[model samples]
Target: MQLTPTLLAEATRRGLLSTEQGQALWDFLAEQEREQQHDTPSFKAAHILYYLGGLIAIGAMTLFMTIGWEQFGGTGLLLISLVYGTAALLLTEYLFERKHLALPAGLTAVLAVVMVPLAVYGAQHAIGLWSDGDARHTAYRDFHYYIDWRWLVMEFATLAAGAVALWRYRLPFLVLPVAVTLWYMSMDLTPLLLGGDNLGFFSDLGKLISLWFGVAMTLLAFWVDLRSRHTKDFAFWLYIFGVLTFWGALSSMDSGSEWGKLAYCAINLLMIAIGAALSRRVFAVFGGLGIAGYLGHLSYTVFKDSLMFPLALTAIGLAVVAIGIYWQRHEAAIGRSLRRILPAPMRELVEQRRG
Candidate 1:
């Protein structure tokens, strides 16, 4: 995708363009890169270290938290969280708004928003309010391991903080924490919505809810992608969370009928096709896993006693490899034909992604 000097030279040598035209194209691309370098951030050591240090701090205080952190008492924890969040916000203002350091600034903003859960948890503890029953003495680390409807408090607070940060800073990376909180919220809400029943955590009812919510989130991500084409990419994390949630739910189904299992395989194949058309490889990755799961079922169940199964599977694998090679050689032509079949609006979206 990068236009390099050697690539220009090769194009000229192949008579694809004259030397002057090739040079002009290279210079134009280089100029665009230079103008965008600040927003995009370079892959240099200093930038890498900057982001790494920020992420370590963020992760230590959030995901890597231990029960000992709660020993400071609720008020102390609340004060500490507030102090850390304020410092991050100030740094974000300086680095992102004033210095135009988009990547690091966005990470700092994320860190600030991620502190909201700690603050909320501390406040709840201070107020003597426990979301779950008889969990007044529950360890803080258990919040992550156990899914309780009570954790909805922290999830909602985190989501709110993330949304405010994004609205104020217009940073695409801030969407990650928001999306994560939303996913957690979906899981935690399962008990509340379908409670008083025997359906446990990650049961079929919860999976169905997660699947439908994931579908909604995926559609929302597509909408954001369309709108943010000229700005920083905001839909990437949404798409990631959506795909993970949807695929996790789909893969966990325990259907007993052969037609149902085959239907699952068909849906996974459809996902792969859609992913290819949209150029989003996440769908392909999940779809491939689903297909593999189905194949595994066949090997372990339907074809368990048959010697021909292994040979047939090997032949299928070889055929797939051949198809991949052929597609790699003719990708450009295939892309053109695919575009022709797409509706006008979808064609425009695909062209934008190509750019």
Candidate 2:
């Protein structure tokens, strides 16, 4: 009838008791079970103090932020508070690395809140609301435009920094979102450059550079995940979705005649095929989009000119036949080449699946 070690361990894991407290409780219960005594207290006060301390700490920090100490030092107090909060959050993370405390998430949230007020204040100081007579009005306008350029630069810098930081911190989860954000910003700037608005062709060039960087970042993310022993998680799926959406949108925006469109479509298809061959999830997602897009185009073509439908069908049939013949002749050589290029583990997987 004595309490078992397994029960004691389960209680600790469930947080009903700390390990030390659980051990003591188990010993007491075992003694009582042996002696037929039932006088011992069933609960301990230590657990209550542990939770109470956490609640007090949270409440104290909340009160400190809510109380208006701004009158004493104005902006200085706010800045000091921000710095102190950031430092404390970082320190807590460093001290409690094993707890999964989500300190990074909290720090990001707090920084965002601090930035909101700073952004509004800077905007107001730069430009008066709806008043042209204010000298600051012109200055604000300039500031606004300046901000656009500043943002472009900052976004690029952030993209690079995020890549390096991801590698340094070994947090592949962050790289894709940051890359996507930078890509989005670059896309927004693309129209301005295309319209000859004088952000310069350099801006267009920068956008193209960002586009390629985004592609590289995405591939790197996949490669890292594939090589990693960790389970594929939310971040991996997010990158796949983002890459597909971004690339699909880009393909739709491409302007060209039938031949040009055909070429673009072929390139997209090749990209997908390569992705599938590599077994990269992001590539597979994009490949699916390419397939959908191709089918949609074929449907549009057939509906627009029913007579062309037969010719299109014949062309597709011939293409498929030709590809099948080529694959039959070259599949072995291609497989060997791929195995040489891939890592040892991945190469073995590829070899095992060769058709």
Best by lDDT: 1
Highest-scoring model, TM-score: 1
lDDT of 2 by residue, 1-355 (tens): 4457987798799999998999888888778564332211123363344335543543343333432432323345446545654564464455335453332432333332223222332333334332436433223123223313333443454455455434434433344436444444644465455553444214535435445545765665556545552332224533564465446445644445777667667767776776667555566667667666766787787356688776887798799899989988998787677679888776754443342
Model 1, residue 330: distance off in Å is 4.6
What TM-score, over all chains together, does every model reach? 0.85, 0.46
lDDT of 1: 0.84
Worst 10 residues of 1 by lDDT: 130-139
Give a tens-digit lDDT track for model 1, residues 239-354. Answer: 99998988888878777699999999998999898787777888899999999999999999999999999999999999999999999999899989989998776787788777
Backbone-clash count (model 1): 0
* Candidate 1: clashing pairs of residues: none
Once fitted onto the true fold, the runs of candidate 2 whose alpha carbons sit more than 4 angstroms away are 1-96, 100-147, 153-169, 184-249, 253-255, 307-355
User: What C-alpha lDDT, on a 0 to 100 scale, does residue 335 get in candidate 2?
Assistant: 68
Counted clashes in each candidate structure: 0, 0
